[model samples]
Target: MEFRVLGPVGVWNRGAEVPLDGAKQRTVLAALLLSGGRALPDSRLCELLWGEHPPATYPAQIYNYVSRLRKYLGPDVDIRRQWSGYMIHPGDGRLDLAEFERLATLGREAQENHRYEEAADAFHAALALWRGPALMNVTEFLARAETHRLAEMRMAVLERRVETDLLLGRYAQLVPELTRLVGEYPLHEKLRCQLMTALFRTERQADALAVYHEGRRVLAEELGVEPGPTLAATFRAILTAEPARTGGPSVVASSWHAVRPAMLPPAIGDFTGRAAELSALAEVLTGDHACAAQVTGMAGIGKTALALFAAHRDRDRFPDGQLYADLGGNRGNAVEPQEVLGWFLRSLGNAEPSIPRGLDERVRLYRSHLAGRRMLVVLDDAADDAQVRPLLPGEAGCRVLVTSRVSLSDLPGAAVVEVGTLGTAEAVDLLAAVVGKRRVANEPAAARRIVRLCGWLSLGIRVAGSRLVARPHWSLAYFAERLADEQYRLDELRLGTLDVRARLDGSYLALASQSQLALRRLALLEVPHFASWATAAVLGVPRRTGDEVTENLVDARMLEVTGTDGGRRQRHRFHDLVRVFAREKADHVDRMAVAASRVLTTAN
Candidate 1:
């Protein structure tokens, strides 16, 4: 028989789990197991089980649970009622808590005698006994003291084991685990110092220093104090690249240099407008606290450009490095998170030979490298939450920026910034910036008209401006007249290599069958915006389903929320360019309106 309190309170007989019944029985067993072979009175057990709310029949209930446990344990375990209370004697049974204590004692002795390898092994064995948080499924009130004591002991043993590992010169191997540990125990100076030492030994001098700065920032922000002397000394040593050696091999260095990857694609030269968004991004990314911002919009709405522009403008702040990966979400067959981590690890100075092989291990190593560094990680064109989730740094010193056409609502704690079409004035400014201010200034009305025709979208405005740049002889009015025809507006909104219709097609093809049908039907309404009821009328579905499909389109950036109407009902509008694209996808407006009127009349 073996008793375990490391996880849920339970007993195992012959390597098979023995059923312990309800919470009361488990509580009784836990009280006796934690007693270390001492007797626990019924009164103490009652208090543990029910606190001050013990019923009049509590003693009977306790006896019933005890009797049941005895029958379950069989003849090997003895549950005897003493003069004071009940005593459980696991004469031939093993107790995991006792084993943990025994191993921890052995580890302590080995460490005192300088048997680092034995000490590390013993401590690791003791720590591994914990299946999860101690007595996790047990009642909080019943397990509070034991839980705290065991958790604190576990942490102490972990620190000692890490110290032993450090003594054994396992710096490179310890980086990933130490990184995770520091995140878990951010306030522990010992762990922080150990991590700094490990980084320094691995020749990541800049990364080691960055860890120190991050620790100082975390301490000051979280606890309103500075790092203790030990951590401070480690930081100082790393700053000078002269780490103190305590009977370990000397650090071999000379060839390795900090990798500062300038991977951001060039920001658009005439990246006009988005002043408010720029300021907001600067404020969020520049803060000492780590954060993530998600930029979402339709295809060709400048989601990638906005992210790149912000990252480039704030490049100097992240002295550690800048990394960019196009997840290829728009192009389809998006890059996997593992692939991105591999590239990021290499960019962070990790050699190919040193990078972990497993996906999870790679993620850990990637985050470890970014632990203390102030870097900007921009994940562009992410497919969805899964692709972006694993790539997030989750470090205070680093800031993550993600761009996707799909809403990353699944990314917890991410500040969502929706990039919409440029305002009319901003759109005109972008045209002027691209086609030369002299031409735009000469025909300001024509420029405004041209932007309106292009639906005030940055890409649309840029494409229109590029076309005029190629034909300097043709005035803005000439292009505006060309785009004036609604039937041919999308076809005309194209310049060498820039095609609005192609971009719209990509977004359209990505939608589900129902949303596609809803969009096609709604596009034929010819209104600036319509309600879910109208969508239901066209799709021949319930209003509720219509609302769901409408929101999906919005999430896919196919529709924009204009505002609520007079009756306080949501009225969704389409981007002018999007309307044209939808019409091109489904061109039966007259028939759609006739069917819509009949559906509306029948519903009324």
Candidate 2:
């Protein structure tokens, strides 16, 4: 049996294509194949099929699709249930998508060993596997993501194949092909350079010169920049009747022409703690790992402060200077990557007029500028991996430090560092820094109580300290008493526009409706943490639904997963102020009823 997804998704058995009915079934198969034989959770499948608006009976619908697909696939193939989701097992079957990846890997390996002809052959074979548009029949969200990624990979392979062909001395044969490629990818400097080299080698020096001039004109008109150093060097060599230089240009001491884009926010005056996190981030700059790290945590956890502080400590490591963008993931109106790229390009010395209007072109120009330079890019408050992926430096010499409320697990090879609330000792020190060290030391007991009342949360401690600062006469005891009230905890945590309640509300508002409701019910539990089944009872949902909502809440940081109960169910905890906020939004009757039910269940 053979499975193909490069064109229309299909299953072929014994040289004949099996008839698969409905777009949904084909979509199911395509999504499974794209997973590369790994299990995809039912919730993820629903998102892939229906996007943000999955029907209430989505689980049942998915089962129906799987049942029908099983009949089509026959006895040999298995679409069985895994612990978390569905896994497709193909016995004695060939999948074209898998073959393409294998061949592409071989091509890359061969090229690295300087086997140009063999590399070109492998690349060509990989390209031949694509019959048409990938998964054309499926319009699911994940399917679109997969298709876009595949298209990009295909283009990369084409570019690599062309590079190998030029190395193999196939100059005249590449002229027409290179011409077509340059026309298709006008901003591709490498392709343009290859065309120029081909023209020069074939004794058409004038034509080669014409190509360089045309490329320069197009680049200035479209992207608002001159030809990059490599392409410019190729043109210079051709004009002097010298052999074109192979590979990219060497890093010249061209600091005068380079843009030293330093855009980081100032480090906080009294940033403290996370000694381990700081050390880990510092290692990425000097260590053998790729110069990238992702700092993720709940709002007000000091992710931005940590990133800025770490970047400043390693400032001297990046000779080209730092680039910063607040993606505003928590701010609601998050900045798009394209706009951030434009800002970065301008900061890197590209004139606004030369910056390309298209996203891909802008990304290309931005990466080209950072090619060999040692730089640091800090993308703060990113909404997701997609928002930050484009902002990453293309080469290893540059490092990217990203901060987000949600974990951007999709970033390939990113070192993920989860930031949590400051410890009691660190929180106390932060309070002293913000207020006054002598006052906190003078009233040690009261200061400890105040920080504890603030829940050891960074923003909470800062706000408490600020209030103390405003009222110089007020003792620490007085402030601690005010925050001690659970009913007014969030209220007391507010100081002008910097409200702890407001910050938490942003994280809550970002959640789905079901998760929001579940959080409200879970908050009414009146315990520090509870198991998944207990959460299910409170939310009046099935265990699966409860688990999903609980996970989302954890991701949002409204609820924290404390541990597991007997290794079967997850135990979740809510911060004191967060619980207060949830209670404010929850209905009185619903809260009381769930609370009573939990009591009864506990007693039984």
Candidate 3:
């Protein structure tokens, strides 16, 4: 028999799992196992199992639990009763916690002996023993009492493993994981220091410095303390471009300190699954060949968030610098390319007086500055290809990641990555992140229905999660029940500035009048998805002109294309949330109302 507490509490006899009944039962077993072969006082077990207030019959309850365990555990595992206290001996059976400790000790000894590879492997093995948070299947009292120590133990092992990987010179491989860790534990100086070193070693001095500055800011805001001496010294090395060989973390090339700008926007902390999209984006952003890719999707589909996430993950890979600009793609007055060029020039250490007045001259000077230097430019919410064109560097070593509602395919040699809504699993994970995991675990079926009602749109899910978070007294079922009403789902999916209606409104208003009419009218058609003929027939226009308007809605991201063959064969539809918004628009607006009524009648 093998007992495990690193994740869910359970016992495996041979290869099959042995049923451990009830949270209280699991708690009793975990409390005893964690006592480390020493007997735990009956009172302590009572407190762990039933909180501070145990009933008068607590001793009897303890006796009943242990007696049940003894019968199930058999003669191989010994449960001893000594002076009104309890202890357990695994005997021939193995306990995962004990094995984890043994492996961690071995890893530490290996590191101390300079066997870094063995150390890394040992630490990896020890960590692999954990499936998730420790004692996760137990009662809240037991989990709360034990999780802190286990979590700290895990973080310590992870830190040591990261150190070993750093010694192995796996800089690129360390970046994505480190970015996530640093985001999670922003207050931890050790993780902050490691991330800085890995970044500088990968030739991202700008990003390394940015990490230090962010840490400094967070420290000041939260605790009113500056960075410690170790972090400060590492910052000095990156800023000075000092080379350290077994001496210091001075890893950047001497010439790189000139103008290392780290201008990536802060990544979404609760950004959930997009494994395939992130992998594809990472390949495009970090690979040898391509330097520019446009991440385009429907409004509020999390295009910007994904772009920033990928950019920050590979920020260290681009050695010279990383630059960012918001071209305000959704705005009526998008930021001009010349204005963005001036900002980039200043970040590159060009004096304001030296910046040329003409757009052509600025582009020349900007490209000239980025000619040989490795850089990552993130142009978020771009208006179009024209707004992004001049901002892009002319060098092969530099990369540009742009996010927009429309496909910026007009940009020469740029790849367009179309982002869709989250899958059911990813959608639930995202909702869980925004709301608490415990709440979702308590009401999983409701959680699934909530994300489904959201049409799996990232913004819709976030907004829905935010609503539940604001109304803490509301149950997941209550929220899911509220969302089931289609007429008010969009309204309920709103909480202080995170309105799905507002997000869709921006994209809707950005469309041409003809496209807007087709969009709102098509919503009146009341179908899940439709082809061009449906739209062409509804709009009372010629097939060719109606097709152009429908395709325009697709290009503008106000509507999603359901088919991919091209020309008249193309099919289009609004996401569930987007359809709701369009229908709401149709009902509210006086001019579109008459046409919408006729379209609805025709469809029926």
Candidate 4:
């Protein structure tokens, strides 16, 4: 027997549709389904079904309905009569509404913990169950009200799903759907806000802003009210081009001339693959809410490249200005929070002398300056929590984009996005994107070898691509040959000027000695995924100490806590580049020792 309530309430028993005798009976069944096995009072049901009007034999009528439903439901169904009212046990029957709620709740929980991919899956599952309006056959006023409630819930779930996708950076893919949704729900302020955000992320700043204006006009003409604070703030963001907070400069500015698209440095080529990654990013930005997305990976995995691609795509969204800063958290001269704030204030046109000296004072002034303007700030290579915090705008009108090898969980309400290696196909495309397609096609096998040798690191691919671009006479086969020599592969890949090693070194130098050692030890594990206990075993330290070390690594972007599954198992993994670095740092003997120990400890 299948009882579906996600659309019209229906029961399929023994291959036939069980006729629900009257509107009241259907209403009773729906009410029971909504409550999900919980008892609802007769009075409440009466109020819901008949409102102020009650039939002369209301009690008798309800009893008769329950009796008839029981006959159809058969022995498997449990219809219990309680003092308050009644309860229906759906048993093993498929109830769409019940499943929908369950999946929605699960998705929400996953999102809260930063498991975006999983959350998207859960939400999609929930949404798929909805065939159409809930209880479409029923005409009772109470049924109509319930139907409306379910419809609203469906929208909310869809919005959440979109939000998860955006956080994953799936902006481009979501644009079409969001456009339609925005039109369908023209008066819904929240939906409008999401549409604007998605449009902005896709580099359609003008369109995003247009959506806000259209929403304002619709609201005024129909409801006689201005846009609410959320919508208003988003509109202001559109006007100023506030960067969504990923953490860097709220805007990027160039002196001497206006910055044009052509002026930006070309991202590393041979960018073989990251379609999934890019799609995930678009999804979060277009999803139905503002999110703080964190892009983290090991040094030289192209975290910056991916972030830059996303920024460029959405650059038009932040018209107030685009800000970029290297926080120096990973290596080199760490850019202090105060220093970044000062630079940001100056970029906003605050003169050096006018920029506040005190940290708190500067933060206040910075936020005050950005109060009503929409700006986009990119804090690249963030060093630590303190370095990024003061730079965040206080108003909701701005967007910040932050990129780090470390995880910045300390940054409250920020969404964390982890970047991994490019897939084989993306690697090939990236190479093609950078080096001419003709050259790659001429030596497809050699090109594949180069990609694998580069470990599909964006930085490595770019360096390899740059080499190919600069040396026109060199064949792809030659580059592959050089990478094949393990002893000098890293050195060979290290072009004197643009070196991925140097970039990674900067972040490594910033770490404390113990943390660095812990990172090295982590390289010993063969398993791609791990937990605190597994990490602890590798470090030869207590679980708490291991946790602290792992946390430090996470902050530094050397590792990411993917999520907890089942019970106590908290999954963690290093970005492919980081893993490569760890392996490079470990000699064969040390690596073997660590791996063996981890295995034994985990087994016990």
Candidate 5:
């Protein structure tokens, strides 16, 4: 019997999930799990469970709960009554919280010795235990407090892991996870700094500087303080082409210095394939003649990953630092260019005392700070030209990589790399990396079918990979069979947190009215790829309107414009995940339209 408390308090007795009945009982179990086998006094338990409102008969209630828990454990359980409180024997029962702590400790130790790979592994193991919020089902004061503490610890561990990964040249894989982490904890300076470093390492100097700037603004506004010296120095290093590794002088004495926060887990998977894309991005960052590079691609086409891989490969070149920003254009609430510039200025060592309050002043300060630095920056998921213009760095020494579902033709001096779906080999390699070579080798046909069903898109491949990993008992053939049905493949692919539907919805919500209508109509067609004429026929619009609408969809990354067929023929297709989401939206919109039409007819 394994008592797991890392998240959702439960017991696994002989591999079956056993629920701990009652809220208070569950809370007690959670407390015990979090305490890591330390004895908790009866008084403390009462206080945590009931706070100041303890019942008059609380002692009896506590005893009763303990007795009930003992009974639930059966004869095998050992709960000793000490003078101060109760203690559970730690044996075979695997408490997730305890395991998390253990792995985190190990990760920290590994990092101290520069065993980054081992540290990353330990961090991954620790993070995997969290299915959701810790002690999610329990509702006692102690449980909630413990849950918060554990969650923070998990974040700290994740931060450390990411730092180690960055040092070990895993920037590309770290960016997505960092993106989410930065969004969730905007005030965490260490994470923001590390994210900047990762972006810089990944050859995104402008984005790295932007991260520092963003952190600076959030810190000042939220906490009324400037960024710490470590971060400021990092910014300076980026600007001055100084080495990032500061070995001799400790910021504080080694023992007295606080432990750096843990790194967030990378967005979800190991880097499987996309070597060619990664290489192209690397050349942009590492070439003798530095230049701005933009990686534009259809949604979920691995642009971010490719850019990240490139940055990680050439992280040492910047040494000053790296920075990254999501731009948030993908989600509709894109950060303004001036706001991003202000953030960059602060990150580049502009103190509130010296920093200009005006947007123009901040832009000048930002450019001045970045003038001589060999930094890397990545503006990820950008909206369009307006969102990206002011954020560009002024110096030729700095490398910038921008990723957008839309092309930024308006941005000057950018060597654009329009990414597309992975070739078959890359897709297959990606799946094999996640699911293991043995499994993929055993079921080659099934593997191909799975990737094909995923449309050779990186995000879709990752989602599919995660699903396979989660259901180890389910054979590849079983998964292939499920995905073989075109009607249900999208539904089957909707597994874990990487919901394809959610990503596509963000794109759909950003569309103009006519383009949205065109997208819905296009979903009605069964063809995998369609021509401009075919799209016009489906939408019942003139060829010119149809062409314009398709172009909008292409720009929005809802559809890919593969090529021109003839004099006026343009080939188009929805990415597999996009198609599924579009179809789902189409059904709902069509139903609503029908209902509205009926109401209008009755009124008439």
Candidate 6:
């Protein structure tokens, strides 16, 4: 049996091509094959099939597709369940995609060893494996998502093979093919450079200069940028009658000229705790793991701090450099994706004049720059998935760490990591790191009381420690005594820029008016945990509405779920600090209204 995904997704049994069910089924097969034997979750398959609006019965539909696929594949293919997802073991089956990669790697290694002829042959073999556009017969969404990278890879191989051919002086032989490639990929500066070199060596100096000018014209008209250094150098050599040097990978990748951006902010000095989160994120993000991770938690839960620490912890993994952007999601003045992309393009070595005027153009150009680079993009305080999506690198070899106060599950290929408040010891350790370990050790009881009073929130604890740092005379017991006042706990948890009130205020104000009212009424009850029925009664809405509203608050990171009751009714609670803040809002705004509702309920 043979599985092919380089062009049209196909399953060939014996000598005949086996017909699959449909485009959707082919999409499933293509996804599994591209996964490199790793299990692709059912949810991902559903997304590829129906996009954002998959049918509620998508699980059964996907299962049926897999079942029918088994019948078509016979007993050769091993498509078995793996955890909650499905996996396919190809056994000894041949896959063109795998073969292509193996040959491509051989070509790259040979080229690096200066074996020009061997490199060209290996690259030619790899290129021969591609029949047509990859995954063309799959679903549209899958085709779009997966094909661009494959096409880029093909173009790269062709470019390198051209380089090796030039080194071997196959000048006249390369002219026709190089000309066609230059025509096909007009904006590809490396191809233009190669074509110019080919024409020059073939005694067509005038034609070589013409190719250069033509590229310049197209670049200015289409992309609004001058030819890059490598292309310009080729034209210079042609005009000056000097030999155009065709160097190795370094020279060919000259068109990929952009400054490697070391844009990650300095790690927080007192970055403490989150061992578990750091490990989980590293598995998905650090080193060669190409993935996007959303560190989600309430405001003041230290999402940004965690992301920065994680990125810095493995900073060397991405030798290409790092890119950081603060979308200001929590500040409520979210930066536009277009603007961030523009900044990123400029940072990645793009000249000001070279950046495209529009968002889509910039996205393509940006992805082109990041195609084969190992870089870490740290997006801090993202507003939502949409705001962060455009900033994401469209290729592998780049990892993204996004810190947001809301769930960003919809962000393509993102692993959402929920960062709750610090545990008691972690909170105390954070305070110790902020202040001094000796002081925390001297007053262990006060440290515990202070962290508990601050609700074990990272920001709250840091601010409380910062307050102590500001007043040298203040003792731990005195600070804990100050935080004990419910009305002024938020007031005390503010020093310089660190303010728990301001941090929590953003999440609170972001809520809809009805949700705002629901949260406030819930705060009026003041119980640690309450059932959905309590929410419905307090909000004067149906149980379903109350469940939805409560869920919204949970998603917003304003509420917490404290296990279900004996009857299996889910109960919700607020962070200690949020409870105080919510109750304070109720006191200032809706205390009397909730009191009236309570009186009416008693009367009934």
Q: lDDT of each structure?
A: 0.77, 0.79, 0.78, 0.70, 0.70, 0.80
Candidate 2 lDDT (Cα, whole model)? Answer: 0.79
Cα misplacement distance, residue 565 of candidate 5 (Å): 4.3
- For candidate 1, give the lDDT: 0.77
Clash numbers, per candidate: 0, 2, 0, 73, 34, 2
Name the runs in model 5 displaced over 4 angstroms: 1-269, 288-290, 352-354, 588-604
TM-scores vs. true structure, each candidate: 0.61, 0.74, 0.56, 0.51, 0.53, 0.73
Candidate 6 lDDT at 16 equals: 95
Using alpha carbons, what is the TM-score of model 2? 0.74
What order do you get sorting by lDDT, best first?
6, 2, 3, 1, 4, 5
**What lDDT tens digits, residue by residue, belong to model 2 across residues 218-277?**
987876778876788887777777674456321111222545878988998899899999
Clash count (model 6, backbone only): 2
lDDT of 6 by residue, 1-604 (tens): 8898888899887889998988999998888887656677675688788898999889899999999988888888899975346888888889987787667767867876899889999999999989988987998877866676577667767767888888788888999998888888888777788888778777888999999999999989898787765677777777887774545322222434547799988999889889899998898775333368888899898898899999998888888889999899978788999999998988977778778888877876776677556788999998875687667775456788989888664453467688988899889999999889998999999999999998888899989988888886989999899889998889999887888999989998899888888888887774567775666777777876777677778878888888777665677777888888888888454667666557224312
Task: Please give the lDDT score for candidate 6.
Answer: 0.80
RMSDs, each prediction? 18.0, 5.9, 24.4, 19.2, 27.5, 6.1
CA lDDT, candidate 1, residue 92 = 83
Candidate 1, pairs of clashing residues: none
Q: Which candidate gets the maximum lDDT versus the true structure?
A: 6
Model 3 residue pairs with clashes = none
- Better model by TM-score: candidate 1 vs candidate 5: 1
